[model samples]
Target: MGPLNVSLCMIVRDEEAFLERCLASAAGIVSEIIIVDTGSVDGSREIAKRFGAEVLEFPWSGDFAAARNAGLQRASGQWILVMDADERLLAVNEAAWASLLRQDTAGYYVKLISYVGDRTGGDYVTDYACRLFRNDARIRFEGMIHEEVVTSIRRLPEPEGIIRPSPITIAHDGYLEPVLARKNKKRRNMDIIREALRRTPDDPVLHYALGSEFFQNGHYAAAAAAFQATLPHISPREGYASDLMLKTAYALRETGERAQARRLVEKAVAHYPDFTDLLELQAILLMDDEQYASSLLPLASALRIGADVQRQYLYNSASGSGTYQTRYLTGLAYERMYRWEDAHEQYEAAIADRADYMPVWHRWPVIALLLGRTADMQRLMYAQAARLPRSAWSLTANVWMNGQQTDALREMAERCEALRAEATVLRAVALAQDGADGQAIDLLLPAASRGNSGDALLYVWALYMKTGASREAAACLKREAGGNPALRAMAGLISGEGAEVREEAYRLCQQTLMQLAAWDCLDALHAQLPAQLPYPWLPLHAMYGYLHAPFASKRELLAQCTRRFAALGYAEQLAAGLLALECGGFAEAAAWFAAAGRQAPDRTAPRIGTVHAHAAMAQEAARGYGLPALSSDYRFLSICDR
Candidate 1:
């Protein structure tokens, strides 16, 4: 145990991209490196030699196991540790390494984590492989692809207790989306499997391999057929049994055969009742069919498996995911079933596991609102907002402003104004939105003087969008906007002019209007719009109002907007106009006005959208507010007037 005698054995081809890191991680751990190069045209051979490896050349025979076996033959250590070039050995203490190799074992089932998305980190699959084994002539790898030495080691006498689990871990990113697209390894693997299948047509493992290759490349129908073909021949005792079962179910599900998938995984879990992956799959199948209550049984079973058990068996673990992800999914199921308190508990559990995960808490404010916990919505926003970096202040404030979370947004903006100009612009925007133009202008005038504070740029935009600032005030904004076409679009919006819309300018204008949270601004932008820009990001629902709002669905949203506007005390005309623009058609509104026979809008029938008809009412309604003098596009100038 003074120094562990370990040989790092690997077969690599054109792996120059990943070789250096792989060798470096194993540098101090392995005594020697045995690399079998399979016709590499790149610097794989040169890089291997730099690491002092005894490189052996093997002509491309399209057989992974044969190439690997050749490398294993050159290993001259008491213990052989096999790895792939795209994998890295996780760092471990020297004492731990020595203790692992000193164990009384023929081989060790090492933990293998294979990432499936971005290599920086995302979802992954994990499993155990007998990667470290005693160098024996009888113990060699087999199979054309998905090769392993476990079957060979099992042939030895009393093999059951000899191959025990170990703490050794290796991370592999070869299967990540970018690597898979670049390497096209799936194509080569499928070709080898098909050739081997011709030689042994009845081999279940080969059938499983073919199915796996098909699954990886997204050929679900073919994968499903191949997986079905392997079922009768597959043994429950095989290392791939659980994965095969899960992949088969996933393939069937992808091919629009969820019923078949449910039946298949439901049957498989009977054998692996304690397997977390299979149990989760069973629950997922139930959830997909909207049998959410019933799905809880399997989810509860999956949760009961304990963390150690969860770690021990991650077979096809992409479905198993992680505890937090599973709990998040469970929360969705409860939410769909209208079990709010139960769903809240599940979400709390999910967030406990991943408190700072943005995706998990992305809509938590809305969730609190849905639960009728207004105070909780404020609290959660404050908590998440407090943790944001300085760079995120404006964007986050813009998001809150656009969403019309008035109290929270104004509070955060006011708090941030003292810290930075970018945040100060947000405060100015908040004031302008609330009709406090003089106070907002005072804040923006000095902010705009400080050269290049992006905060000042938006402060100017607020002046143009909300405050009806004089020419002198707009000059500071013009200087701040520079030559950006998107910033220039606001001039046309406020001046009653039209221009062909550029995508950037158009998006900026749309976002600015939404951020203002003013119905008149939103309505004027669309009403005087030069033409519809086909940008996908354009909010058509916000643009055409109830024109996009399905006629049947406007009642609730109208009620909501109405009550919110009513609470402000000075937004009666604004509320009615917004209702017409957002939930009722302009032509229908005009007809309601015509039906009122020139009477004041409020004197008209209250039902059948008479209030909405106020959106296009006559001069009596337009007078005294100076609506016509401000801008031709300014439709509801009296929105804030008492």
Candidate 2:
């Protein structure tokens, strides 16, 4: 029943905002508190003193270890627990702590969940650190930045000292965006890291640390270079090596070095075959290349590894390495292969595992519709409505899916009534989608009267265009354009008052047109356009309109669009080919499909389309009394189909 005699030590500078919360959380757990303030102008010192902490003022020597060691030296407890002023101890198992203290372990690894951004939905990155350790003279902190006491502990007589896992969880939010914007922490860390690297030029740990810092800052090229430099010195047995490899692969991918990234991931997977993160990355790379069938093996491997396995290093929560994520990725792979039944099963399993994962909810409906599973769709809608009862978006989507537009509009109005302008516009969009453009316009006009312009006015313009009220549509568009210069240029182009406006607003226009289902308006806009649209998909929208309004040179137009998209990439080419098939331009579709198949042989869409195209050609040839080259195409397609 005696005190465990745990001392909570912290080094802080201008951390008044978070210091009180941090100290209060550990007040009951820690027997003693040591606060080392390194030149804090704020009331951090007073805050620490208020908590009865032994406050020591240390000079700012740009060394985190020196400040940390000052606190450690003042601590009078049997055990030391190092914590930052911005971090709070969430939970601790006193029984486990007492048990661990009685053991011969030199240190304990505590779970540290650091919030990287807004923490509204538990958005955090988890890692384990040896923050709790025995209070021995040999166990002192090190490094100018990212200071650690592990190295000092490792130098003990038992170099491989037993480091046990303790039931302590710390939540840190200093890395979140709001905090980062207030304090230039990244730049400060970079400065210290550079200084340390300069002192110990060949330190692999410093290099890896620098690489991680750069990766977090979105400097992918610099991060990849630093990671590559560390690779030669990093030992495979070291815990940080796997993390280094994984981060390097991600950096390489971000830098557009996909081939190199794939090779590095594959190499890492070969060495650490059971690493679910590596396997998941491999599957993602394969999927990005459109090799859906090939991605299955890695996805299966990751799923088999499961979430129960203990991780040696830090892992991303968003990565598809966990049970729900692995199942979701497996579902995506199955869907790409056109195995709807298998895909549906995997998706259902994923939903069952983590019902609150919203991405699964969005994709599940599409799959259900594709498979014509109306009953399944209804079931999913009901389940989602139940799970996310407070989510207005989910409620709206559920009502819309159930074919209750009136109910959906009423729900939207009730749920979002506080934001009257936004709700009115949203309700109007729902009305427009339900073929009530006049009512949608009537709903939007009041907001327009109240001088609501930007998005609201744009919606009104679209409604007028949908109702064939050209004069009214133009007036609304011009009014909307008055504020957004980009819209002004686009409006001028559409109204034939100016030259073509090739800015990014074209995509927005295309999206708006698609939402309105204004196929004729899209065609009119496309005809007046001076050059090709920015995105390949934009043309497809206009082409879709031509599905009903067929033209003599439709195939030629489709072929031109397909060629343009083919030049962009395999994904775009596949999309273009599918659009062609949908528009009945079989020849153009066949050419693009063959091209895509050549680029990515494992893609099912291209292969299936090729089969359909070849079959159609063969039937036409037979009808014209001429033999077709069906055997070659059919054989290749059949192999891919299987």
Candidate 3:
């Protein structure tokens, strides 16, 4: 009935941005607030004062435990709650709070829900942190970085009953990309962790911390090495054992060692069958190698564990692996296996679980498209659009634009007034492709002159080139590029003196190339493309394969193009193989066709192309051996012709 009298304690430095949010979340619950400011130049101290916190200035000794100990010493309550400036305290277990404080327990493990990546959305990893503890003199914090009170608690007598798990959850954003950059936390933690490792050379905790720092910063190779080093000493009894194994597998995954990663995850899963993160990771590794059937096993097991594991914090598993996200992954597996209806059902379940999930949003409609349910797909698209704010029309349009779903895009343009510009660009592209070059230019010039042109300008320049005004087209493109890297790359690409561009700009280049190819502009593109490509060069190969060829000799030229597409990926294999078939290289064409057949067995084109390629190979053999060509052998001519 009375106040729980929980003391909220934290140590902060230049955390003015998140300090207020942290304090506000706990203001109604905590009896007193104690924030030890470690030489903050910001309003962290002032913000603490606003929440009626006891602000203590502590000199930065480069030891988090020391600073934390100072705050623990100042706390005057039955229980202490530790939190970071970037963390917001969630619900407290009031039912157990009084009993746990009165009973024989050193502390409680609070669930820490940390949002990963740049966006602070649904995707998060959960861990149990020792943030709740008794305000005891003997239970001060330990370790230099990632200081823990549990270590000190374990040092006391009868440690079996010392620690307990609670329903308290803390939502952490310190791991989010932008926040980590603003705080310069990755470097700080790595420096401190390395220094600690120097003192205690073979420390499992320090190595784990080092791996985490590297993993969060996208240095997966270094993270894998750090995580591997910890494996020799860590036991399953360790709090971070499952998490350590999970992270190690992910590090390998990131570094393109999927086979090794899958093996490690399988072994780890065997060791920790109940670990949801391991199960989810196992599914991912299986899916990566195109083993869709095997992937479903782990995914099903993960879902079987379900909300039971999600509700608990045994390991730092992504929050949705046991729920909607797992379903989404299952949907992917089914989709890859071409089980359209099954995939559709899983995607539906995922949407039912979390309607706003963008990953599902993109794939859900595609399933309907796959089933030839265009009307159903349109309905699904409308349902998703209805959820989004009207101001996000561009975002909605972009999803369709990226997919090149012209019909869906046109439908959206008809429904939303904000999409008129995008609709104009699409219309201009279509007009230019249909040989309406002058009309296309007229439609785009007004948008360009008014400085509102984005993709439209690219169409304008291409249309100008179509009119045989190369000089003016170059000038128009230069004006359009001005300072934009994407436009600059487009110009560079067209002039046959290409330069490297950033990834974002390169994607725009890819998108623009698709439009340019539609307008029958491959001769310029093929001549202008750089010798080396930055992947996703599908448009180049796709455009070239459609050439109205004489099927004449150009063996070396076509071979070089095939090799380039091969380097990019198997996405353009059929197109590349068809081009090879057009040239005078029967054996080479057959090889390309065979590779493409293996890549897409379900597709009729690759299979038919393979038959034609073999027929050509037979004809070439006939020429070499002085025999009748296969096409003249009436028995197989029909199969080869059609």
Candidate 4:
């Protein structure tokens, strides 16, 4: 029935750019405004005054808590709402604030969304902070850098001290790239943190704060060290301990210490088995190692436990470890296992939960194609075209997939002509795919004329070769190759110049040759490649096997690639075994698959591969007795079609 009497408090310095916007956002709701200026050369003070704020001057003390406390002292309202000049309070109905004031709590945790790059959509981090609190002498801010009043609130009487979630939301853009670049905020914070640490050397909170700052600044090694140092001092009851462990593991992983990262995660999971964030991290680590089956249990645990544990005050576990994410990851694992039906089901569930998740949309068509669900694939393409109407790839794919002929494609291309090179390339590829080499060439000529012989130019050359225009193809290749030794060698070979292929050239040309389906050229390139392929070439070998092998010869080629990968210690044994089985190497494939199954019994790939291999061997043996065909063999054949 009456005003809530909220005081909006802020500490600012050179925040003229955002001060007015921040004040305007809260002007209607706040009863009084307290602005503690730490020294602003700009019009920040005038901006605050314009908003009828009670402006007080405070000398720069290099302590955020001290400045914040100064603002807190001047506040004269029943409720105090803390905010920065770079933050704006979201519009909430007055009834929500009235309801919040009715609660018997000392403080409330307001949701804070900090944008890093793009402000639109969900490209930001979610945090919860005690920004709303009773304006009492007992509650005051503390800490030098990452200051807080929550610790003081916790010292109040039990029932009166409860801090609960409020409807209040704040959007902070101080951490965005452009804003961060404008000021040396990290350096200033680091200085304050170091000074504070020097004063209180045993403070786990300072260590944690320092680690978080380092992580934000991309100092992974320093962040890892700081986070690791806090472990011994951190209490299990501390809400941030789980987050610290997660950050430390992530930092370690970034520094190429994945084993150490995994060990840390394992240790953390052992301690806090119910923490869904920890389980999700474990699942992700296992998935990264290609231990898909092993990943499923942790994923299942993560999903079963759900995101109930709010262990961290700053990080939102729901961003990546939510139900939709878990289902999506499970689907990916199923896909790797070649369990198309199971993968599709999980993917569909994920899409149902969050249709706007772009990765799910992208993978839907691929899964549909693999499962021979042409109608489903067409539906997905059309959906993508509608959702992303401006996307050239989506438009082209939709046109190509639907009953739209070259005329429709041309119309689409015309619509996208103003978009430049990317659109042109998409249209050309569509034309090329439709066997209109001349039309594709004509579409590519403008790009070629501008001396832009990138991938599109190479694609145009491939089209010329397809059309039997040898001289034109040679000329295009020569122009596009330029000074690049790899492309030059490729051009030389194509032009019948008898150029010797350099190892680098062969590596470079592999992609283009694959794209062109120039099997003979790939064969020549392969001969020039090193006998002992580097670790990075393992995927290239796999790609070569996929492109080169026909249905009848696929297993043998895949087995050869698998053996090479195995020799390099880079192949997932289950993947290799599947290839071996496809190639009819029953004994070796069966042995490897069994070993894999023994290692990860929960994994579906080895189990399915083993069943199909056994069935294939049985079917082969039964051929002598003229027995009926096996359904397992047919199922395996369907999987191998792609």
Candidate 5:
């Protein structure tokens, strides 16, 4: 009946550049601003004070929840919108916020949109985060870095804390800054994660946090090892298993272990086949491994499950080398089989999803030309021309896209002549794509001569494939390795050159051991190393089989992987349920998931499969099937939107 008074609460440290922007985003909506400055020397307190934000000085207690709780205690508003200094509320969702606060909702969930790296929007848009809630007394916080409040919400009784959905997003741009700053931040997070790991050696979240923290710091191998450590601690039927499995697979893939990554991802899907993240990651990894055909399963799974509209756009853009990447891949698949219109529809659908994605615009013209749709080719070419950037690549695209009869070819040749060695290699590929193998060779040779060892190796390999010179390509790869440490390592791993392969493997093994030791787990380090010497590293499957097989071979290890994989799915559900329990005042749901691992043997090995509902049940079983309640007679019904 009355306007709801909302508080803006945040815990910040050294956030000067974007703190003002964050506060400004929510300025007009909040009744008060509570800022807890944890040892910020970066003008953060002064900036908050300028906006009439109540600045509370708190020494860094190495605990985020404590600072946040302190901020909450000082707030007077009836509802709280929690935001970090590096995060900003989107202007587009202002109306939704106003409506949400005015309603009788106990707490609201706000979506988080992250900008991966580039401001121009390429190669990113990774995840969403929940950032809104009621200023209810029941909600409390926990943990340090990546702290959450939902854990405390489970202690509430009755229907006073029901979760209401809020259609708003907070834009996170922390990753867009300089790489060094990002690295430094990750280093700090690593300390916190390591501490958490020490405190709870068997905690899956802590292991995952440590792994992810390592990955964020670009220590890919360390990340894989850390993620692997979490696998043994999971209670198979618990909900967080999927997330741990997915992240582990992601780390492996990023470390050039695509086969292992793909296999692990497949394992995740086997457990929860419809999990959108699993499906997407599987497709992405398959494409990177150049397994175009294998990529289709997860790609189609993603489509069949109907992902978010934004994600659907990304899935359709995946066609760099595979049909699973975009609809054009589907069309191209059909075209390969001479199913013309089917291919056309797939291409058309891909373009419709987002013409901005490179694959659709590039292929439509080429595909049209092949199908004798000259008119369609011309139309598509003009559309592409309008959208293409005014770069050297676009010039080629314009020529190729326009059903290039004569002038385009001449211009392309001239451009090829003008480009540098690296650019020339690219042009040669373009020329090859245009069916001018001889000219492509001409462009490729000179380019290869002037290129770096890496580029030269690629050129030689391409030439070998183009000219049917397998021996030459192999020899070139060997020669390139003599001059490049990175290449030498990659080549040894792939070619089975015993001495070099052993050397590289030893390094990886040593690094892995060091990571495990640093994180305080020696047995885990031993388990990761293969029993036999000179392990196969040709395809990723061999590598994955080596890392996971030893563990998967033992039933106890297998069960643990299953439980851990399941636990991740449970964690997400728990996050939502915890939020609901806090807002909805339903204590049972909280107690149901919070209690620890006593999952039943009959519950399918979590690695085999599970749905969200199944994951919830598995999590409950992991909690010993005795969900805590506010009162003896209270039976908490989980608020699930089926």
Candidate 6:
């Protein structure tokens, strides 16, 4: 491998913070660095110059693919390696890149390991994009936001180096910053996406991109509609349909239509059973349905499909998405089924196959701890802690799993204080949970006083709700709702505020439910709040308390609850069973857990805890349904518990 000529191509704008790092990482490897500046007032061009990159000033083009194609034209190397400013060349893949360039592969499909700041490790949301292609092969780019290099890649005349499943990866630290900035970037992107949509209404790819834009921007309703609009126009072309269908399913799920989403994915899988993207979707849906057993089939299929590569795969050029992403979903599904061993195996495999992935390490021990594998959990926690800072989520998990309450509590307090008001609402709940109500009250009251009072009131409400002060909680909510329109709307629906209020509440709930966790009711108050639309990133039931209310027949509610339980995945089955218990279906709810205990593939602690909780509730019910002696007339309420 004697100094193989490599062209380092990139399109950038205001990437001064990362340009030097990126260039330095590829310094010796690249024969030429072709930098296409898309309007940089931040001296990004100067920085590129410092790194000896050939900086070309291209007027800001709305099309990312076009800008990239322009850069490719400037690249004069035997092989072209495309990269992003915020991405770094990982040390792990250094050898792979060096070796592959010497080989006769068509092109190498490099992996991306993305990291979100303050989290544990890299996200295993891996994808294989043709980064290294023979320059004479003439690969060009297409599309806007998520552009393509189809034209240029297609020009490669020979069966050149095509590396499909190479161990090489680029470390993506682009998301390792403030979320507000990310949101702002996405907002700008939405403008372009909206423009694109207007120009091409019938394009499924555009529709999918717009839907993703909306989803990322916390605009679920619009996102869902975009995806729905693409449904009739979904491409049935062999490989492409899987990608389109998967995106649609995600949009569907985020919009609260779980059943419909599942059906769409099922159809896609039927057409392409081994499609990794569709298989990942199917696995997620199955996990939601608490059908852990059912999920195994598709997940296994995805892994097998993803791992089976004959040789280096090349992308000559297609305008739409050619990359597939599902490592996160598969690893997550394994954990949810309580198969800690399998979960660990998958996470490691995903990372080994793509080490630039950072997030998988964040949640690895969650399943390990759930399975009572304390030693394994500890080992992973410490390993993760070493790789990340003390404030990172991985380190936090280590403290939490090891029962280092003092340190974890202190760390959480710092984090809560560091976050803005909207996020501070959650800090209040954590504080309250840790028996620091005084501190919780201090952190919540000032923010709650403002009109922006999100779910802070809910934390206080939870305190009252837990202490058997329903009337007090109701009264407090009324006052809070009176002051804040959003709070009022939510209070109206849950507490029967008024007709106008209930309608408003429903709209808000619909908007915000996607960000909320799948199982908890307490966290969903933000969604149900009547304020403008709730933030889409807010996790609902996963963090909040929900009361299903009295049903006409326990059987119907039980069935509904069972399906709901199944749809959210087995990790939440316990929560669903609890709801079933509250709905007066004690035996059925208890039986659900009993079945789970036997059938669950993973041995996570949450599963074990849920089984115990359900059993205890069942035992309490067996003593007499925990029901008051009913009069001949049949009454459910007992003095309102005032």
**Which candidate leads the pack in TM-score?**
2
Candidate 4 local lDDT, residue 541: 30
What's the ranking of the predictions by TM-score, best on top? 2, 4, 3, 1, 5, 6
- Predicted candidate 2 versus true structure: per-residue lDDT over 524-589, tens digit per residue: 665666545444443432222233323433444454554455345555565556556656567877
Give the distance in Å from residue 403's predicted Cα in candidate 5 to where it truly belongs: 9.2
lDDT of each: 0.66, 0.71, 0.71, 0.69, 0.54, 0.57
Error of 6 at 534 (Å): 22
Better of 2 and 4 by TM-score: 2
Model 6: worst 10 consecutive residues (lDDT sum): 633-642
Evaluate model 3: give its TM-score. Answer: 0.75
Minimal lDDT window, size 10, model 1:
633-642
Query: Which parts of model 4 have CA positions greater than 4 angstroms off?
Result: 1-4, 117-122, 217-225, 248-275, 285-294, 304-318, 335-338, 348-366, 373-378, 384-424, 450-455, 482-621, 624-642
lDDT of 5 by residue, 506-571 (tens): 444333222111111222323343334343211111111112122222233322223343343432
Worst 10-residue stretch by lDDT in candidate 2? 633-642
Error of 1 at 434 (Å): 4.3
Candidate 5 displacement at residue 620 in angstroms: 72
Please give the distance, in angstroms, between residue 461's alpha carbon in candidate 5 and its true position after superposition.
Answer: 28
Stretches of candidate 1 above 4 Å error? 93-96, 160-162, 306-311, 319-322, 355-359, 369-399, 406-429, 437-463, 468-511, 523-642
Candidate 6 off by > 4 Å: 1-3, 92-107, 117-120, 136-138, 155-167, 176-183, 231-240, 271-280, 287-642
True-vs-predicted CA distance for residue 329, candidate 4, Å: 3.0
Q: Please state the error at residue 432 of candidate 5 in Å.
A: 19
TM-score of predicted structure 5 = 0.55
Cα lDDT tens digits, model 4, 394-490, are 5334323232233444555565433344667657755755656678788888887886634677767766766667788788778777877777876
Off by over 4 Å in 5: 1-4, 92-95, 102-106, 126-128, 158-161, 177-183, 217-220, 232-241, 252-267, 283-297, 307-351, 358-378, 381-395, 398-642
TM-score of each: 0.71, 0.80, 0.75, 0.76, 0.55, 0.53
Q: Which ten residues in a row have the lowest lDDT in candidate 5?
A: 633-642
